[model samples]
Target: MRYRLSIEDMEPNHWVVWVLDLPACFSSAQTPVDAVALAPGRISAYYSWLSSHDSSLPVITESIEVEIVETFHSFASTQDQEYLVNAFFEDDRRPPNYWDVELALRLLQWTRQDLLKVVQSATQEQLSRPMVCEVRGSIAGIIKHIAGAENWYFDQLDLALDRAQLPDDPLDMLKAVRTNTRAQLVKLMGNERITKNCDELWSARKVIRRTLWHERDHTQHIAHLLAHL
Candidate 1:
């Protein structure tokens, strides 16, 4: 028998963390809202359920399929920024820590897409906005800073650079930053896994986490600017 568990919650972290009853077979995300927010169940549960011989359980592998459905409007009120996605599980189980690589790779892809989207959304005038510590300048600067930080990592890794500096043109700079950041992420993906228990994981994780925080912080600022405009 194949048993699938789907849990959803709107309170105390809309991001669901699911796992199998087996030692550890789960994933969590702070994105999305809805039916996909449940944690994984234990393996023993699956075995027992499968013993019924009525259904076939999925083999949980390294990757759990998570969907981020935008339930609310992108420009919804700041007070209502919560969203959810659906989670689908099969009759399979993954080894403990199998999710490490999957999680890292998924996050890298999401961040790359996010950075590209943001840059592409802005106009040349917006990008060229004076660097006033204001929201406009601050957001622009944050993007530039992320690109610069990635460059630092690449240099430390002795990775080859396709570009020495961001283009002086506003639009070109945005394009360059997106291209360069993607390249850095691609290189980082090839490196050995950073142990979760090790301090080194912080360096890479921090960069990615900061990317998220930076976006959220500026997202609100942009909304405020839009209000006044």
Candidate 2:
């Protein structure tokens, strides 16, 4: 099967590769060639893992398109990255039943990881630096906002997870919130009554759409902010 691989240089000899169609699935290698070569196996492994969890296999494409970009500045933003790395499966093409929920979860996971990649190398000063954007806030503030918003949606569904708390380290806070929110979502998926709630505010479809939109929206915000740093 064919897939699209977006390769980015991380350091002098390090590279990271993202399998575009498969959310949260990526691999790293010392060289671009090696990273490209490793992608198919990583993709296969991801499918294996997914099969174990949900008993479904993803459609594999026949060829892969490898697009490489230069190393980002240590604190640079991803605003200018040409590849559409976060593309999710469209609703029209989604499988019926809970499979779409699974896909949404995967997309959310990928969005969180993409956000982390943008800020992972930032120093404290960079993270705290002010940014001029529609969402006016520091990098850390934005991260907190993203995490907090997710928690709020969970709350709307009456999920009992705790609200997101900002920690001394912004990335740590992100990790905690993502873990907690994902756990709650897994629980939500298993509860049909909750998943199929008729109310507009807590319907499973609305929750999934909103969560994905919020995550993707702020992810772009962070990327644009970092680009100006």
Candidate 3:
């Protein structure tokens, strides 16, 4: 399998290589060279992840190839911005079918499970301990950020989740916001409506892409925090 890469240079040490073929899958490293070098491995892992979650996916192949086809420079974080240079793959414009949203929902379920599992074992001390390396400062902060981002994604299309109703506990808030995410996303299953909020564009495909990336990215972030704590 050969996956085309779109590299985003978000500041000096933060480089993200987006696998355009697989919407939600990406690799991050300190430099463009290392980030591109990491793409093939991430592509393989992505396939393994999908196959593990849904047996309907094709059998994994041993060979994986990736080429960097596009690159963009940005100072802002990809999580903060709704758009990336390669954010809208040519593939994304196509109207999604039932199976597209179904598979995405399944992946969502698995990624959230992966996240909760990582955080579930953490002691209260580990959750609250501040870290200089993390922008969100601590595991607990990251959890809230995850839920908040999920809501913000929906609001990009003017489909807002009620903030007043969210729980105070980070984990519970994550659960509540995800329930809202699932409902909104299900409505987008066969609908191809696209809307723009500010300078950014929103579509069902883009929403799914960013939502998956944010949650999965933070899941790894929390795992990293747990490793060093």
- Candidate with the greatest TM-score versus the true structure: 3
Best candidate, lDDT: 3
Give candidate 2 misplaced runs (Cα > 4 Å): 1-96, 132-136, 164-168, 190-200
The 10-residue segment with the lowest total lDDT in model 3: 82-91
Report the lDDT of model 2 for residue 36: 79
TM-score of each: 0.37, 0.51, 0.84
* All-Cα superposition RMSD per candidate: 14.0, 12.3, 3.5
User: What TM-score does candidate 3 reach?
Assistant: 0.84
Give the Cα lDDT of each candidate. 0.41, 0.60, 0.80
- Angstrom error of the Cα, residue 133, model 2: value is 5.2
Candidate 3, number of clashes: 0
In Å, residue 137's CA in model 3 sits off its true spot by 2.7
lDDT of 1 by residue, 5-109 (tens): 333232345443332222122233455333244432333433343333324544444433343322321222233344221222231112213353345345445
Tens-place lDDT per residue, model 3, 49-72, is 888877898766768888878776
Candidate 2 least-lDDT 10 residues: 83-92
Q: List the residue pairs that clash in candidate 3.
A: none
Q: Rank the candidates by TM-score, best first.
A: 3, 2, 1
